[model samples]
Target: MSLPVVTPGETDTYEDPLDLINEIDELKKEKDASIMAHFYVDGDIQDVADYTGDSLKLARDCTQVTTGTIVFAGVHFMGESAKIMNPAKRVLIPDMLAGCSLADSCPADQLQVFQEQLRAEGRKFDTVAYINTTAAVKSLCDWIVTSGNAAEIIDRVPKDREILFVPDQHLGRYLMEVSGRKMILWPGSCMVHEVFSIQGLVRAKRNNPGSVVIAHPECPQNILEITDFIGGTEKMRQHVMSVKEPTTFLVATESAMIHAFQKSAPQHNFIPVPGIIASTGETCACNRCPHMARNTLQKVRDCLKNESPEIEWRDYFQQARAVLDKSLLK
Candidate 1:
């Protein structure tokens, strides 16, 4: 069943944020539910979540959830993922409208058409999709990967078969460089990551001397080129935590990601690299994903309390589940 979209502003009825938190806590117990939040969500939602992490971490962590209901405080694809993993439990998302641009870029039908075209030319290829894709898209893929595990999974693919990496061209390009694997890349990118300004990054570095720039691979080559360290969200956290000395980090991913970084290593300073509007060349805070911001404390409480907008098991999920198990579980 399709879920009704809930906006962040729609859940602003609560007078006290503390009261909403308490209500959500109480509702979780009453409904036998667990909330799994993505790190990209607001800090308040993350604080209230039973589990919080990057996509790969959350995908593995949700499988271990014993709750009767799972409220995913992220985007729609995440809700679908949780449901695919735990078909026995009910999976609910705070906002159905919280969609990923990367996922939307590669529709399942378009992928199928492209694969057919490649096959007609006698090209043998295996599809490797980022976990940000829809379940339908996942079913079409031979392997699923997140930024954290893409390199490892890419290594596992047979050397003979051509690789078709979808839905994030920047990441696909980066993987090709690191793994030395040539891939037919689907031209897609994360809306947030693609917008980060190279000019802003240079300015930030100049302003904060000795500050290290850590970027996600999803970022364009220009951004990743100037970065000191490049990795996924979990890896970024590990990189920062490993440094014993107090340091400033210019983060070149989603701005909300800085919340997790700050919480994990409060002693260190973290700055978000500003994005630029290409039309105007003005610096803006476009690094924050609008979809991730759609999830709110009020919506979490409402979803848990109502439990109407739940993710239903799909026939295609069985196919996707096999890929997820092979790609993520091992």
Candidate 2:
């Protein structure tokens, strides 16, 4: 497999960064709107966002904001999660089709049947839906969990109760390993997270001098063996931030995160790691989720200006929001 181009990234401003920041500020004053962006978004959107974070922070942050409109600058699942939390607030995203592959993999129809099957067996589960799933799926859940706080929130349930964790089998297995709880995990995974390879990463370490490896726990077990650090997006961000030495690190999650990583710790080095290869003559490398790329400045402006892109989940979804409400109190 060919090695991917990873870099100790740097930002280049277009015209002036101040002008864009000022425009967003002016818009905020006039419209009383808040822009929430994902770390994977382009630097301009990140710069303009009132808050930039992963799913956990994004959901929690929007719930706390008093704004009338929330312009979500990320994929479909994110915008839906925001709306699920802030139903009274007007929620919009730059792109309506900004869907997640992981969410797409677990359609509501199939999950509903799966739930019914569990019920048929005289079993009831305290459903813990991963934030990576669709709002429709979240509606079926008792509580929503993000990578940032899944384990903590899982412990909130009665230890004897059964759980059905949806949308990422690897993450579900990881949870089982750490939490020691048996969950009916749905067979789903993000293509990006599914690609990391342990052998390929070892080869990368040997080729790139002074390269430290970092990873997200959603990765398959083999790739995880080579990583120096493993955690959520914020944890990874903090890892680089707390380091004093100027060291190079190879990130094994989504490559887009490198932009934020370098921004926070400019002096430290960051490289994107390619995914592993399998015996089927396929190399797990150079994969980017198409949905996350849907966000752009122009679309964000349109959504906020018109407020036409409204979101709604089924009644069950809205009803399931009680679990999220309870989580907020925690």
Candidate 3:
């Protein structure tokens, strides 16, 4: 049976995101459809989502919900994860093209070859993928991890065991630096988080005097080294909410987060660490991960109605399921 399609107002008549936001509740039956949005997306979208959370929290959510249709407002990687976990259910992304630079940094074939090499050396790894990765990557991984739980989760592996950490080299390095462990790290990165230049960071610190630098662990060590606090998107948001009497904060992550931070802690101030690479006098350069930006109220509506851009998990569920089961087997 075909799903009902709701036409979004693309014309001059509908100007408010709230209008589209409200329409979703009525269009998609409250019981059947649910939206899972990340902290980095537009605030209005987050506001409209059935549930809003950071990556790790959302990963856990895949177990809790029983929705027939899932519309993830985050990047392709995240939506793909939801689908991988819920193959029986329909998983849709507002924009199928919305992609993650971090996931794209390491190709599937290349990583598979590396895994083969490690096996040849008699080394076995328990793959723990970041939620920022693609379904294919997650499919290959033994378990999934978010920044909130990476440290705790990864720590469970044997001390002498060799592991391959994917995508964000900065976060990998940070984990290694903090834990004093050795794991082969893939040289992949997040385009948005990786763009905060060390030079510009210094300038911000110098100018802001009293402002403390708080960054995501995915940032380069040089950036994370001088930071006052280092954590994930949710951690950053909490720091802003819980902290008091801070004059200013230099946030070294996606600019979208500034909206929520400002809204929650109006007393303090924030500055988005400028992405020098995104605007280097180029003809066109926008650092916002195109994948994360593809979602809109209009796209969300289309996905609910047509289920047009559905994500499919490639491997047998038991394959990935076994890996997750083994790693999570306590």
Tens digits of lDDT, candidate 2, 54-150: 8777878987989898888888878777887888888888777777888888998899899999989988688888878776777777887877888
Candidate 2: minimum summed lDDT over ten consecutive residues — where?
Answer: 1-10
Clash pairs, candidate 3, are 98-291, 99-291
Sorting all predicted structures by TM-score, with the top scorer first, yields: 1, 2, 3
Query: Candidate 3 residues 104-138, lDDT tens each?
Result: 88777788888888899899776666667765666
What candidate 3 gets wrong by more than 4 Å, as runs, is 1-15, 278-287, 322-330
lDDT of each candidate versus the true structure: 0.91, 0.78, 0.73
Model 3 TM-score, 2 decimals:
0.86
Q: Write down the TM-score of every candidate.
A: 0.96, 0.86, 0.86
Backbone collisions counted per model: 0, 3, 2
Candidate 3: residue 272 Cα off by (Å) = 0.8
**Model 2, total clashes:** 3
Q: Is candidate 2 or candidate 3 better by lDDT?
A: 2
Give the Cα-based TM-score of candidate 1 against the true structure: 0.96
> RMSD of each candidate?
3.1, 5.6, 5.0
